[model samples]
Target: MGSVAVPSDMPATSSAEPSSGASNSPNSPSAEGSGNAEEEPTATPPSPSDSMAPQGKVTALRLADFKTRWAGGEGWIARTDDSGKSWKSQLEHKHIVNQLFALNNLEVWATLDIGDSKQLKLLHSVDGGAKWAEIGYVPNYSFLHFVSSEEGFSGNAHTKDGGKTWSKLPQPAVIAGDAYFHDRNNGWAVTQNKDKNTLDIVRTTDGGKTWTTVLKRTTAASVTGTVIRSAGKKDAWVELIGDSGMSQTSYSLFHTMDGGKSWIPVLANNQAGSGPAPGYKTGQESKVPSNTGSSPGALYVVNPKVAFMGGQCMACDLPNTMGKTTDGGKTWINLSSKFPGYGTQLIAAADAEHLWWINTDNAEPSIIYTSTDGGEHWKVTHTFDKPQPTTE
Candidate 1:
């Protein structure tokens, strides 16, 4: 089946808005450095006679440069070497590109959506998008997660030969969203049991060959696992939403030290009772207004102990707040009073001390913020402009 679409106004803790089809605005942020500032080159779409096809829209960063798959495929990949000032086109394929994974500026992977009749295909490039080779095919899959070029998971299969070949593994749950691997040998997958209205989590120790259910529960409300990050085999963090009665929902954060055997509530707040998790800390209760439908904002876990959490106050006029916990979710303190926008979309951590986030709360020309000293302070890095019309 094709990927499910989530509305843009949904709470952050619920479904995530699809990033593929959004049009790039001209007023988006520009690169700081100067060189050539004009429309980037566009690649010609692959023809039936071409040897390889490309697909999917995946974006990543290597140092200062940004790389992204162009919308509707058209066989063009965009890269801005000098930050966001100027861009150049690379790679062209016949199929629509759905996702792009950059190991660096050199090695990258692209997943293609080849319509419903045929299985999805994977392509790889090692020389900075100069050329691409067909790696393998994944049946009924639309996403790609690779820890490295050689080690990664696509659909229900794991690949070790850099996508040249894939080994079909045991599937985890029926409605699995994404799989996060701490390494090639160990990882976690999150799924939702729609009938039970409960979230299910499973772990794989030997790549994706096998999985073991670690946690399953329905605590008086239907929940959806938003994001999961593992610091190691035993320590991990999860963001989830709990639906209360009468069209109300609560967002909560949990931590696990025993490989999901047990989870400790680090933070819980919403229209019901906004406060810190028990035994973690006091004074840091959430400031979101009641009846506004709050949810877990953004979570970035650098290690077992060092992490950042953003609490989103949905449909509220008040600004959102973020908290930090350096002692493994034991205690949290206010990191930022209120972000400039309505909500945060992505929280990527370069390390424990450096982090970045993009605000997506109904704002125009999205802004990217970076924090070098944890979340203590932030500065605007780039403003994403709407993509220009393609001539393919």
Candidate 2:
């Protein structure tokens, strides 16, 4: 009995049921509803290392260049065309791949979690990661976005006949948290309002049906998650997160060129309604190393100018910062003395100089950091191993 740690800002458990004519306009907020689709879980029995090859805990990744990639967690779905050096486990089962979508290495999709029974399933893969196919049953979607192989989006539900079939997006823009879609209808979300202490930044364009709450931040402390990123159509970026008392977590950085209407507070770690975001320089006068406090752990834009922000305080191991902005972000510089201070977890990109820094903070080994010359020289390519526990 050891599992009580839910505070990344809590707000995800919707039974959804708001389709048919969908609408929401008193400032839009209604589209998350759907519940009546869960009948695909009868085929268990393949856990004792399935045949040994795929490890666990990588949780969900989808690179596709710098040498192909794709990773899922615990129950495996691995792939690596040789950047992680070698890996190719394509589908071992025990169920625990929270979310993964690779729209190009030959179409793919995922969202499994059906072991300890929190229930969820939605897998697809058109031949890239070998084969996998269960295409329905999904709802605790805190976030998941696919652009094709039918169509997808699930901060609440939407499938155009790929994930079997699912719908409910005529309003509930997002009630739980996190979402990012730059195609199938344009998107961006970081929701959690209705007393969850405030953290909205919604915007959709007929894709998720409807939504438009441009911006809203209500913090005094006690906001825990929010991350939205975009790089094309007018640029976008966000990172709210709060609650910096002891467990540490404080962040702020909002920017929208013209998309979300308006926003620009490029980094307001002192959090309190935000200040300094006019064009450049805040904190250590734009040097970007406040002795490790604001929690910049990851963000990689790569467009509209250039971007990459970092911090990795694995519980205060500190000294793992990395910042850079070309102009769109106004100003930033500190490259963390050229890298490696540990604890990055995840950060990916394919432009503005390629990158893929991940450091699982030791889930058994996990470590990988690469950069094409953007973060200014970084290398350590791959190192992952430590995922073997399926019992059966």
lDDT of each: 0.52, 0.57
For residues 1-392, could you state the per-residue lDDT of candidate 1 as single tens digits?
A: 11111111111122122222212246432222221112323335344544332222223322211222211233555554332233355666555565666555567777777775546777777786767788776554634555554666654566777777777565565644556655556667766666644566677788667878787655433454345666566666766555443333465667888887776667666444533321222454443222112556656665677777666655555335566777777676665335545534455554455555555433333445554556555545455543334459
C-alpha RMSD by candidate, in order:
11.2, 19.7
Candidate 2 C-alpha RMSD relative to the actual structure? 19.7
Best by lDDT: 2
TM-score to true structure, per model: 0.60, 0.31
Clashing pairs in 2: 16-33, 16-34, 17-33, 17-34, 30-171, 30-172, 31-171, 31-172, 32-172
Give the per-residue lDDT of model 2 (tens digit) for 1-392: 01111111111111122122322344433212211111212233345644433654576676645567677777677776644545667788876677675656666778888853534788887788687878677665555555555666565466777778776554453453456655456667766655655566777776667778888765444446666666554457866665554444556677787887777566655522343221222343543323233455766665656767776454444335566666766665656433333433566665555566655643355555555555454545555666565469
Residue 225, model 1: lDDT of: 35
Candidate 1: where are CA atoms >4 Å away?
A: 1-77, 80-99, 112-123, 129-143, 172-185, 189-218, 244-249, 272-293, 309-322, 337-344, 360-363, 387-392
The alpha-carbon deviation from the true structure for residue 51 of candidate 1, after best TM-score superposition, in angstroms, is 27
